[model samples]
Target: MISFHFEPSSLSSTEKRDRLLKLSVVSSPILGAYFFSTGDLSSPFACPLREFTGIPCPGCGLTRSLMAIAQGHLSQSLSYHILGVFLFLFLVLALLYFSAELITGHPLKISLSGPLQRHKRLLFPLLGLFLLSYHLARLALLWQSDQLLPAILNSPLGQYF
Candidate 1:
């Protein structure tokens, strides 16, 4: 059986951030699949960062993109977020991996983390730069279209202010 445990004091800031990032990326595809299977186009979860900061998080458009992909609208998905198709493909691979594990009675030890850990010094910075650039571009587009203020005002937490 699975168990829940917490030890906030044991984790460093970097560890906490890494855990949060992993949770977001890993959970998105699974949750998207669940919503798709259930015919729920709307996600119940909102990005806490976006809600509070009135800014789109790196993963902001993911759910809508996933929804569009589920409906076989590739162009619509790309418009929402360029990474959605990649995430969807990752989800498919994960499902296959899980199924293979079940059939073979042996969990595949696919160590994606090994390479990540090895090159993390270089990889992490590049990833951060890319995310930052993409976020800035997204913000610029919103600003150009005169949607920035509206986005801020319409944000869940912003609505109260």
Candidate 2:
């Protein structure tokens, strides 16, 4: 069995980011295998939040969204998870960044950090709120259309409905 320890305080931010990018490179194929084997927007991987609360958290359809994006179904992917296209792009960017870093002998200057540093505290929470709102809106649409019934019916309060 494999075990892992993540002690970020021990490493410089650049080193930590580089390590994560490297890990992303290694995990792409594994993610691809999962996406292919799962075979649709409904992943076999269950969300604990959804199971317990009868409502999805912000990331419910991410895997399916990424898979759809991989299959060139951009619109469908966005319908599954609004931010998944951006997520896929970030994954691609990380893969390229790590690959380039490996081929070159120097560390690259990180992008996004400069801008993020200015409003790090404010930006992250706002982004989280935006994503949660988007997810709730999507769920509302699904619920109105009766598409989320099966999931709802399986939760603890399913007895009342």
Q: How close is candidate 1 to the true structure, as a TM-score?
A: 0.61
Tens digits of per-residue lDDT for model 1, 1-161: 22223322344556545544655666567666556745645655688887786888888888878887877778987888888888888776666654544444443454335566577589768877887898889999988999888878887767888
| Native-to-model Cα distance after best TM-score fit, residue 11 in candidate 1, in Å | 29
Residue-wise lDDT of candidate 2 within 1-161, one digit each (tens)?
A: 22223332344567657766786765684378345745555665788888876778889888788778767788998887888887877777677665555455345555344556666679778988999789889889879988688777878777466
Most accurate candidate by TM-score: 2
- List candidate 1 stretches off by more than 4 Å: 1-44, 109-121, 153-161
- Candidate RMSDs in order: 10.2, 8.2
Quote the positional error of residue 135 for candidate 2 in Å: 2.0
TM-score of each model, paired residue for residue: 0.61, 0.67
Instruction: Assess candidate 2 and give its TM-score to the true structure.
Output: 0.67
Q: Which ten residues in a row have the lowest lDDT in candidate 2?
A: 1-10
lDDT agreement of model 1 with the native: 0.70
